[model samples]
Target chain A: MGQRPGDLSAPARLAGPDEGIGADELALATRNHGLPLEALRHDVTPPGLHYVLTHYDIPYVPDAGAWRLTVDGHVRTPLDLSLADLLSFPQVTTRVTLECAGNGRALLTPRPVSQPWLVEAVGTADWTGVPLRRLLAEAGADPAAVDVVFTGADHGVERGVEQDYQRALPLSVATGDDPQVLVATAMNGAPLPPQHGRPLRLIVPGWYGMAQVKWLRSVTVGDVPFTGFQQSVAYRIRRTPDEEGEPVTRIAPRALLVPPGFPDFMSRTRVVRPGPVRLSGRAWSGQAPVSSVEVSTDGGAHWEPAVLDPVVDGHRWAWRAWHHTWTATPGEHAVGTRASDADGHVQPLDQHWNRGGLANNAVCFVRVVCVADACWP
Target chain B: MGQRPGDLSAPARLAGPDEGIGADELALATRNHGLPLEALRHDVTPPGLHYVLTHYDIPYVPDAGAWRLTVDGHVRTPLDLSLADLLSFPQVTTRVTLECAGNGRALLTPRPVSQPWLVEAVGTADWTGVPLRRLLAEAGADPAAVDVVFTGADHGVERGVEQDYQRALPLSVATGDDPQVLVATAMNGAPLPPQHGRPLRLIVPGWYGMAQVKWLRSVTVGDVPFTGFQQSVAYRIRRTPDEEGEPVTRIAPRALLVPPGFPDFMSRTRVVRPGPVRLSGRAWSGQAPVSSVEVSTDGGAHWEPAVLDPVVDGHRWAWRAWHHTWTATPGEHAVGTRASDADGHVQPLDQHWNRGGLANNAVCFVRVVCVADACWP
Candidate 1:
């Protein structure tokens, strides 16, 4: 092969200073950016079907033989442990619904300048790991510690700032009796994929995914609150850079309609024979258990309560499945769903406007055509 | 659960006439938009890892019990065959590389306003299908037929045009003993996934993905070329509305550098050791087989020929792997690769600008940092 003159040099200009790379570069930086929204139409999301978001191209897979995790800082004892050591600790497995802080960012009016995630940036997974509280207790935390910071292996430049992936939580949330906060090593009963953060990752159940740092390398307990780039800069919900916006935490109540996905030739709606059409979906809340869910079939003009599955093990992080049976109809129709948590937070008709578009629980509606018969024109 | 005041009615406006839905709508309409660029770094893309581009939300999975494939139009005898009948025809399984016509559209200067794909919209798969020639012969295609039109089950409004997904090829290419032209029933040894087009889909080897209609319903031979919405309007390349631009077909020769995606703290380059590092990737062409591949280590100032894997067969639809080894010195470096086809069509330094941003075969480069010893700091 001989050198082609224009080929090699032209693309280099794209990386130059004058022409700043735009959304296209951000879109290309990760392998699997997000999952298709249709993926949410399923109750139990398959591991491969799960959505993925990363700070960088999937970080290198560390050699299992040499990997280590360190816990240090204001604690009485600084602990450095191998993967084997961590595994030996009492293991806990729990199902948790994780939503990215930027989940509904795309729907934000005047859209936030970020990953442009749609509704599919959320998923529920059965994570297996050691509890973070147990690990912190073993390290003997200092009383003066105010925040616990978790660091990941992935790093990149974003908004002209270079940093490794880092996020923090208050000491109270980190060391609580809730066994749901885990140092997850496996997802869906299998070892975490590299993109999902292999070997070790933090699972801050109920909070947005940003707190669940992947490829966990260190945990530091600090006397002062950790004001890391990811914590104070990127994920904050502020209109301007000067404002100290609220840190996004705890997902809002949201319910999705899992249609049967049958195709209809008229009006972009799924076609179903005139009979009982079973509509089902999964719903969850970060701060409380989902108390109930409601469905609307006439463009929100009418609504009905849906049956909710019994909660499993009083886990606040897990999502509850909801089902509603719509009786026979033979015309165009739209289906919408909403959920209310025990905390009295009902899914909103319209999302509260936030600059970052974080925690948008706006009700989602799907259109379907109820056909008289199952015959194609 | 009772209906909240604004919750039900608010979201109805999103599907309104004034404000057309944006990215969130587009993302929900397809199962897979494009492959993550990082996924292209792998040699044999896993079945699930393959990129998917569809006209609609994976059209409701067709009922296998009622599916049929009809062959008519300009044929001496029409044939409506069931799944079993088509499966009984001698199967021809072949590995083929499929690239979206809009593959590198995102990188175009003054970027095209489309799916915004950036280089990862290509993959190779082993497809098991009955040859189109066999099917056409069985139906007795008419001597006057000039084009063969393939129609898919998907239909929707794009660019204000409502129509079913359709495309066509000259009768010569359709029925010419090219075993590569397939009526694919399976991919990678399993039944095709709904997202990838279940039951049946057409595989026009070496052509851009648009020509490979999914959820194929019928193969119609016509006396004249087909002028459907997807064929005459959408996939064509033109700078102005008045110009009846040429239709995009056949994959172009392109090369990509598959770097070891290691993490580097200093720059966004892959981290490597201070010794020899081997870089490799795949290259392919539509008009001809990949003749050779070249690598550039110091930007584009120097180039060296890389070893290309022997062609597996005369099938020009598949890709060939290329590898290059470089003696490394500590520091950062950019790696680039380019390929030339047997037809003397070398990968372009810069892609020619197109209105729809189709047929982008520009060269690709990757960056890496060589560290001293194995220390990250």
Candidate 2:
């Protein structure tokens, strides 16, 4: 719903190629592409509207003197390669979307404190690069070592706590193939941008942006976790704020905390002729791939099945477009979409707010203005 | 473990911050601050070093522009001011840790695919900043709007795909004392460096790095969410990569995926006259705060409570450091930490893996070197 013939009233600004969230721009309405409607505006998230995260730091704008991916940690052949060297590895390409775990925070209830996201945290693109697994294989990392630390170019301190923006991933996640994660140098068919990790970045199709460490640096394989400031105690949750006295673990998986429908704006219009209307939208899974998408015309009582679009198998990152048609006789109507993942998990309806905006996967909903079928009266 | 006279060789020459992981420096060692005698060493993660995540996109170089704090989400009146403005309000600080969601990946059986991060994904720090909840009151956002979106200046559009660094917070979280989210413009005592968010950056005491958007831009208040790709579909699970139709909806809370004990390389150097050797470490929560931390010395056998370090009540973002001594008889011991939050949620031993490394909270382990006092003969 971004553009309508005469809707020049809406801002028609194009995000500069390099400009991310401009320092001066005020956040108004925003959403992550990976999030659902109630949580995010699905269709209208423009290209200049994606989200990003770095493991250690932001795009290094690496000094030409030092631009390499060093393979250290517990490995047989400690290796380091220049950007040019990465090019020599067999390149791989896949269309993937990187999202931040906290992407859909805008809609969560209980009201947690977090980022002021302008819709567009999720971004899907054809990523071309070297498979990190391929590199691990070539480097001959110790199979016993399970963690892989991905350092970024961004740097700084967080209090007396000198810290890095680095994060770690499991060997399994590092080598899976739903989309086959990779150290991407190309996105959507172009070279990476300074804001998007120019020389190299990780393209982890179905993860929160943090997993797709923006600026790539060294990949350390180790026998034990490095416990860097970022990996040891951050990004966690327990049952409640009062629950943890010693150390707490993490938040449990919850359904997309949407109202029931998504991208309602796309279905919006001052005028709507009712007849056989095909309601269409997209549904996806964060905890697992979605199996079915349910739609409700009436508030929440009965639900009708909607056809799901085809997506690459097990590609949890890509979303499935869904559609359902309804006979018309309209006044006002409510529509909602609920996704059920392969794990029998369905988008939930509500979530009590906690301190950190951890996991809020509630059902999504929206109100619609319907009109009677046009006819000669 | 790093320095011991009349025993191990003198500490290896300290590698310059810019130096790559080399031989002597290959095995990283750190004497965890609070813990004594029981030091551990790994091939990565040097003490005095950890990953960092800054909020601003611009480098933190001494510059001209003054920094300000903006509070507009769901408030009655939107407020924007500079670093001076934030400082004028009030100042507060807390010790906290920020770990990447997928810190222990190599340990996952079947080896999940993604960045093979072995070590160095955790860190701790004392943070100082103005409480955000108070600012929201100052801004006067509508009470009905329960969500606030935070945008950042670091923007990137690659191959028609645009990604921004942003996040959203629930009203409860934004205005709370515990978790006590901060609009931080400084680290330790110094002004935030350009590498970090110079003028300002948010310090969400608890939660994954994904929620901590760097290069923050603006904040918006709304009754419902404006979904972006990141909010809905990413950071989810796709149970069983083999089968897929629609992806799952829920966003699992981020947690530490503790790996099996590092029983290898590390041997018990003490424990000759085993008595009560205090075991201490840190644990944190994401959505909710931690209630208690328990330690398991015999795999999942019996559990004992650890003395929790001081942590502010209602603070979900901050972690509770803990200590508990255990008497041992030499050989090898598996020490693990598991915690529960206010919601009664506890950490598990395993978690499902996805292509993208998202919320991976599993009870983690700690291996100790307990040698029988060198078999003093």
Tell me, by lDDT, which candidate is best.
1
**Per-residue alpha-carbon lDDT of candidate 1 for residues B1-377, written as tens digits (9 for 90 to 100):** 22121211112111222222234333432234455445555545555467777655556563665788899999888999888898999998888888889887666775655565667778888889999989999999997789999988876545434467889989999987553589999887878776677789998888889988899999999998788877887788887656899889888898876655453221235655677788888889887778899998877778899999776765457788878889877766778889898899998777787777888788766666665643332
Tens digits of per-residue lDDT for model 2 on A28-140? 11101122222222432222233433222233253533577888888888889888888889898776645455544444443333342322245456678999988898899
lDDT for model 1 comes to 0.72
Residue B371's lDDT within candidate 1 is 57
CA displacement after TM-score superposition, residue B159 of candidate 2 (Å): 36
- Candidate with best DockQ: 1
Residue-by-residue lDDT tens digits, candidate 1, A1-377: 22121211122111222222233333532244555445555544555456667766556564754778899999988999888898899999888888877776655566554455657677778899999988899999886799999988876545434468889888898988653589988888878866677789999888888888999999999999888878887677776657999888888888876655453221234555677888888888887889999999887787899999887676567788888898847666778899999999998877676766777788767766555533322
The Cα local distance difference test for each model comes to 0.72, 0.51
lDDT of 2 by residue, B1-377 (tens): 12111121222122232332221111111001111111111111112233432211233224425544466655667787766677787788765566655454434443333222332345555567878777777888777776778776654221122346556777777777756778776665656544345567777766665565555557777689646434543333444433432322211232221222111111111112345665666566665667788888776588888787676553345455567777865555566777777776677777655544445666555444344434422
Deviation (Å) of A299 in candidate 2: 3.3
Q: How high a TM-score does candidate 1 get?
A: 0.73
> What class would a CAPRI assessor give candidate 1's docking?
incorrect
